[model samples]
Target chain A: ATERPEALLLVMPTDHAIPDVDAFRAAVAAGVPRAVAGQIVTFGVRPDRPETGYGWIEVRGAPVDGVAQRVERFVEKPELARAEAMLAEGRYLWNAGIFLVSAKTLVAAVTAHAPDLIEPVGEAVAEARGDLDFLRLSEGPWSGVRDISIDFAVMEKAANIEVIPLGTAWSDLGDWNAVWRENGGGIVTQGAVTAIDCEGSLLRSEVGGQHVVGIGLQDLVVVAMPDAVLVADRARSQDVKTAVAQLKAKAVRQAEVFPRDHRPWGWFETLALADRFQVKRIVVKPGAALSLQSHVHRAEHWIVVSGTAQVTVGEDVKLLTENQSVYVPLGAVHRLANPGKVPVVLIEVQTGAYLGEDDIIRYEDIYARGDEQGPKR
Target chain B: ATERPEALLLVMPTDHAIPDVDAFRAAVAAGVPRAVAGQIVTFGVRPDRPETGYGWIEVRGAPVDGVAQRVERFVEKPELARAEAMLAEGRYLWNAGIFLVSAKTLVAAVTAHAPDLIEPVGEAVAEARGDLDFLRLSEGPWSGVRDISIDFAVMEKAANIEVIPLGTAWSDLGDWNAVWRENGGGIVTQGAVTAIDCEGSLLRSEVGGQHVVGIGLQDLVVVAMPDAVLVADRARSQDVKTAVAQLKAKAVRQAEVFPRDHRPWGWFETLALADRFQVKRIVVKPGAALSLQSHVHRAEHWIVVSGTAQVTVGEDVKLLTENQSVYVPLGAVHRLANPGKVPVVLIEVQTGAYLGEDDIIRYEDIYARGDEQGPKR
Candidate 1:
């Protein structure tokens, strides 16, 4: 009780699905006392199936709700046979990698185990800058920080590690199969999907107009986005990483970038692009303004499809309403702003010799991005 | 042999793939004499695999080159076991549905059997009209004719049907699996696709820039188009028909229509569409002209991305080249024509209260479609 502290920190992966918030809160509250007492606490979920895709954690004794248990050992994701055996043993739980610990204890564990990582990571945080909202770490120090999970660097080597049995359904959702499993198991259909005679499949289309069809298929995952589609055997969902690497090696833009580019104010999607022209659907939040910019090699036509837009071309400033348009000739300085209560939606047609996003030259920006030229637009 | 006539009619399915032209010509040449001698000749290919998706012909005698054999019973697409057994039997051949027969004999045979079809079909031919390069059959009579295949309507009932062995590579391309087979099997890929640790799979993206990723997939078919994505078991390729029918029942447009709308001139593909806006990339064939028309509900902005376009807006007629654009206001009679030797490619952005294809009122059309507006352009 002498090591007990007043504050404790809980670490969880943001992308994981833990739908029962109250149950999760109760489990975290249960672990907090042990964590404050200088015992690094991990949470474990009872397994319902012999899932070979997740790490299994063995407990020393019977697990009780709201009670921390002594850790036996950590096991990596096992083969089907091993997973079945572990499931039959009745003491193994899914290692969800959730952790509860005091800040001092985590720091001490990291320093004791991965001593080499402490300096660069600490420097990165020390030199971080507040960019409007986000605290961006220093690039130079961050680049030197080794890319590793806390479990491999600290939990696996710590001596005072303990686990609390979480009384809620949880899933890491590490891959598409996990997503399929999280959607209640039998033929998960999401967004513009039709399944005929399909079982244990995930047929998903991310966009509204893109329909996904599955026929006479078993245990498959088909995910369709605007620019890319992924089809994989549900059992082999983890192997999608290698396919992504192959796409990256071939310089496919979809490997690293999404079709919709999000910005501080709103977002824009390239509807169509070709050699000398590009069409974009842009939405600007109310009171948001794009940087005063112009392209040397392109002329743009902006049509206000919805809401109101305050448009500026050269020295002329005009308010364009729905179904109104303006043409910005090549080299003309222009700016588009949503000065109304609603978001401004516009269709922009760019005609140019080179229509790359890098062709922009910003003269002024209200969002504090003045001269920096990137693909943010 | 007196059944032979001086003229022969060879019928083949246009959708079939017969890559060996010389071999096909030789086989046709061999069957020509037999067909001219008043025999109804049907071509059969040697079975290469246990294909359950195609009809099988049981031949009594060993096949010889340029020789005809007496007709045997026609077996429909069989189960896997029957297909495998037939594949093992050396006397079985794939009934390709190609037929060679004399016109007089076919008409006489058709008159003898299936007597009800002759009147409606003959009336449809009698009332046919020439529209450009296509012979337009009278819909009244054509609709009265039963939707039946030649095999079921005539060939199966005809006692004079004889089989001719054709030594040529062929494929009906009945479904995605047949496309995979045509593409040379074992991990067939088309367009932008990346595969990792995959075997016996067909991963295809119908349009460029749409990348398809397949990982650890086996015996599967994945096809991604602009409007729809289909993932199915390779052996269940034929069942895609049921999926399509289900889509049709659900009133999915992709089930019946393609994304690209083809006109007599060229084609246009819709890049994006919203409630009141539509963007299309249109390519007009050289020397082709859209109808002199006006839309009451929508206005259009046409940006010439490539080649040259002769534009007509009211009394103003201008030739716009690459990187140039023109605006056609609502209720203004406008026309777009490709007067240059090369095709004209343009991006059309429409903004309106109602942007339906039926909103057009045409004055004149060089393609001879006048006074009848049923969604041509």
Candidate 2:
């Protein structure tokens, strides 16, 4: 493996809220020396409540900000009574999972603890190809890597790991209750929503053209997305995972799949779908192009709404501005490209007898896709 | 006035839930003779709870099914204490406002009490013109008529007004609370919805392709429609009218206007809209046709998904079936007629520089409209 052994890596969860960036930076800077000395520094937070949801790090000394302390042991998420007893004992800190470690230390820890993951993960990383601004990881080897958290695989089992307390307001936003706490336990709202007589609630309408209204709601969470919705008690936000599991069991598309189809050329969403026709609002990123493809059953009519598009229909390629249209007959090889510096937005109407997402014939794909059909576009 | 003097009229509210149709019909049959004898019979229901939202009728005797008794007075919606007292008194019945009266008596009572409204209402009805299956009342005269409920304008002051107890369970469904009660106070839902750990709540999704999910909701009302959503405390469903008033004061179209545009041809709802393009799902009833129309700023592409449509573009006319499409050029006269024995469903995509609703030039309308702009389609 061509590892950056000397480079320091900071681990942060994506869905987290850290309000005081300066304090986090200070703690990270303070832990850099211990990381440079080949020690794994895991950040912890002083427990403000007997939170049963998080793991606890029992430190040898009191955990303090900007100073690493010796770890006694890492405790799994405890029962409520045990969490309360630990909170009262005053030696336990939340395992925030934020880590700063040198690449060599991480590699050595993983090799010593979980040697089986080394070969497949490295192969997956090495085989990944660049697609536009993102890296399309090699799926073959990646699928073989066990779905395990880094903490269990390397952190908890490794020696020379210290804990540093974060001196900042932080929340993982792991659930709706966490989000509610992050918003100061008040009625939090976003998007086109109207709340009346609601207390300690969060109402969000994340999709366009959908309005969410909450009335006489208390300690409830209502989130409206395009294809799915989540309405739950703030206290039961953790149970949403169970609901998601149930949805996945039923093979619902909205269980885990996002509403919009993301491709290397930006994204597209179906505005409307019927038995014989479908309408989509497609956005192509600046300088990005769709696959040179054609459909066997569907004919498409594309009308540009904003920016400009380089449209290919059969042997002809032309530029289409706002309000300009192009027709691609069935089986006519076509493509759409954004040549301008802004995103190209267009509406596509596909008329067909058999309209499924698998009816596409891709002659070439810039994203390195093979004959795998997409949206039958 | 040309009065059908002997006609016996039974008043049934559009919003009421009279689940037992035979019970309602039997009550009507019993009241028919009283109504024919010129005694105004107002139906009353036995109170199931101390509901303060309903008006009450103080009858001279114990109310019984299928028998008319003298009405002492009509008490307006009362406060909690008064409604509770009335519920215990056993002589009070809900003034259901379902009246049975002869046309001559109704006309005479209105002429004696609300005489100012008689001329305008009579003229409006007299001048109403037939448009399709509906009669379009003369707007000028109708607007001049005073807005008053029949109970206030005629029944409350009329002598010999009798209260007949209805032998059935019924609900006006005047508010969301009433709907919740009608649904038996459990988790009531309609359309695509999921309720988790919810009790005493109503969750509904009235629009197509919209999903509603609720969790841990109690004593709440959530209604999702195409343009507006109502979420409120089940206890304070009455305050929803205040929210509506607020929206009206702010000139929000969703406050009072419907999202669908209803015309003689059938109806159409906007599937999507943007600055330069709009998509609509239009359904035309069998044998119905749109006007010969053209838009100055937009061109339309119509793709039929169901039935058959006789489409006229400029001077060319063709019959299109499922999966067939036609392009209507800007400034070219076109019409869509459903000639088949079923509704013709089509998706219309409009491309334009300005996509306003009033951009139409109507040449001829079978529904008898003059030069007035419509979806500017």
lDDT scores for all predictions? 0.85, 0.84
Error of 1 at A329 (Å): 4.8
Candidate 1, residues B1-377, lDDT tens digits: the string is 12554567888887789989898889888887788778899999998888777888887887775678877878898999999998887888889889898888888888888888889988998887766557878778998998888888888888888888888888898788888988889999988899887899998898566789987788989999888898888988988888889899999878877898888789998888888899999999998889899999999988888899999999999999886778898899999999999999998989998987889898998866774547776
The model with the greatest DockQ is: 1
Least well predicted 10-residue stretch by lDDT in candidate 2 chain A: A368-377
Docking class of 2: acceptable
Candidate 2, residues B63-145: lDDT per residue as tens digits?
Answer: 88999888999989899999999999999999887998888888888988889988998899998877798898888899898
Tell me each candidate's i-RMS in Å.
Answer: 1.7, 2.5
Alpha-carbon TM-score of each model against the true structure: 0.86, 0.90
Residue pairs in clash, model 2: A215-B232, A231-B215
Clashing residue pairs for model 1:
B3-B37, B3-B38, B4-B36, B4-B37, B4-B38, B5-B36
RMSD of each: 4.5, 3.2
